[model samples]
Every structure is written in structure tokens, then in C-alpha cells.
Target: MQPRLNFYKASQEAYNAVKNLENYVQGCGLEPRHIHLIKLRASIINHCAYCIDMHVKESRHDGLSEQWINLMSAWEESPIYDDKERALLTWVDAVTRVADTHVPDSAYETLKAHFTEEDMVKITVAIGVINIWNRLCVGFRAMHPIDQPAKAA
Candidate 1:
């Protein structure tokens, strides 16, 4: 699909603000894998193919297992995730769909079992950042780069 516009070039200051948030989220002490999972799952829910493709590549580069990546959309039924991971995923769903879920107490209670107050804030920030990115990418029709076959040596 053709892009609606080059968001970055169209508004450098705005893009830079988003980049700043990205930097903060990266340093917020959440595990790298958790960050990737949150980003990927939220992108899937938001139906942002560009963000989904980007996060999948990043996650793979960080050595996340293919099985885990494959299970992101149906994480509840996957055996690959632990209790903490499950809780985080649950939280992501609640917050990402906050308009509908209203981030119910049950979701908060489950998250509290696995994360401290500070960690909860960090996770929420991570979720918020990803949601913002998903909206921008999808709205702008950002396209993920097409994969090319490896060249013979």
C-alpha cells in the first residue's frame, strides 16, 4: 500500500518527541523481551502491519524464540509464556483496549502479583507508547519493507 505521507519528514519535531518516548521506554528497566512482546501484541491488536513487521524483526534480532513470536496473537492458549509474561500480556490487552476494558480491577490485580508499582507504571508507559505508534503507522499507511532473498556468496 502507498503511504499517505512521510510522517517523519513531514514533522520532524513531532517525530522526535515520539523518539524521545521510545528512548525512555527502552531505559525504563523492563526486560527487553517483555518490551518486544508488548509492542508486538499491541501492534497486532491495533492491526498495524508496519509496526508488527518492525517489532517482529527486532524481537527476532533479540533472540526471542519463533514459537513465542508465533503465539503472540493467541498468547492465552500458548504454553511458552510464564505467569509473569501472561500477566503482562493481560495488562497489555486491558490497557490497549482501555476504552472497552476500562482496565478492570481483575487485570490490575493480576499484574500486581507479578510487578511492583514502578514496574506497573513502566509497563503502562510501554503500552501507551506502542499504541501511539500503532495509530500513527496505520493511519499513515506506513509499509513494512519487503523481504528480499539472500544473495549467493
Candidate 2:
């Protein structure tokens, strides 16, 4: 599919805002796999092919097992994910699919059980950033690079 616009060039400020989110994700104590999982989950909710391809590949590069990545879409029943990971993934899905499933109190309570209030805010921020990027990429049809591979050695 053709992109509607080149947001990176057309809106430098907006691109910077999105990039800042990446910086925040890097600085957060969350593991690379966790961050990538959140990104992939958000992309899936938004149906952003560009992001799904990019993040899925990145997750693999970061040594996230293919089994875990494959199970992410059905994380509720997947035994590969730990308690903290499960909480964060649930949060990601709820946040990304907010219109359909508003983040319930149970989600918040579950997340609070694993993360401090500050960490929860950070996690929310990370999710929010992914959601924003998903919207922008999907809206603008931001295509992934053609040479990008699904996995890297």
C-alpha cells in the first residue's frame, strides 16, 4: 500500500515527539523484550503493518524467543510470559484497544501489584507512545523498509 504522506519530513516536531518516546523506552528499567512486546501489541491493535514488521523483527534481534513472540497475540493463555510480563501485556492491549475495552480498574490493580506507581506511569507513557506511533504510521501509511528481514542472525 502507498503511503499518504511522509510524516518524518512533513512534520519534524511530530517525528521528534515520537523519537523521544523511543528514548524514554530505552531509559526505562523495562527489558528490551518487554518494550518490543508492547510496541508489537500496539501495532497489532492499530493494524499498523509497518510497526508490526519492524517491532517483531527487533524483538527477535533482542533475543526474544520466537515462541514468546508468537504467543503474544494470545498472551492470556500463554505460559511463556511471566507475571510482570503478563500484567504489562494486558495493560498494552487494554491501552491500545481503549475504545473497545477501556482499561478497567482490575487492569490497574493488577499492574500496580507488579509495578510501583512511578513505573506504572512510565509503562502508560510507553504504551501511549506506541499508540501514537501506530496512529501516525497507519494514518500516513509509513512503510517498513523493503530490505528489512523478519529475523536477523
Per-candidate TM-score against the hidden true structure: 0.95, 0.90
Candidate 1 residue spans exceeding 4 A from truth: 149-153
In angstroms, give how far residue 5 of model 1 lies from its true place: 0.8
Evaluated with lDDT, which candidate comes out highest? 1
TM-score, cand. 1: 0.95
Clashes of each: 0, 0
Question: Judged by lDDT against the true structure, how good is candidate 2?
Answer: 0.85
lDDT of 1 by residue, 9-127 (tens): 99999999999999999998999999998999999999999999999999999999999998999999988999999999999999999999999999999999999999999999999
Model 2 C-alpha lDDT per residue in residues 39-118, reported as the tens digit of each score? 88888878988998888898899888899888777888878899998889888888877887888888888898998898
Which stretches of candidate 2 lie above 4 Å from their native place? 147-153
- Minimal lDDT window, size 10, model 1: 1-10
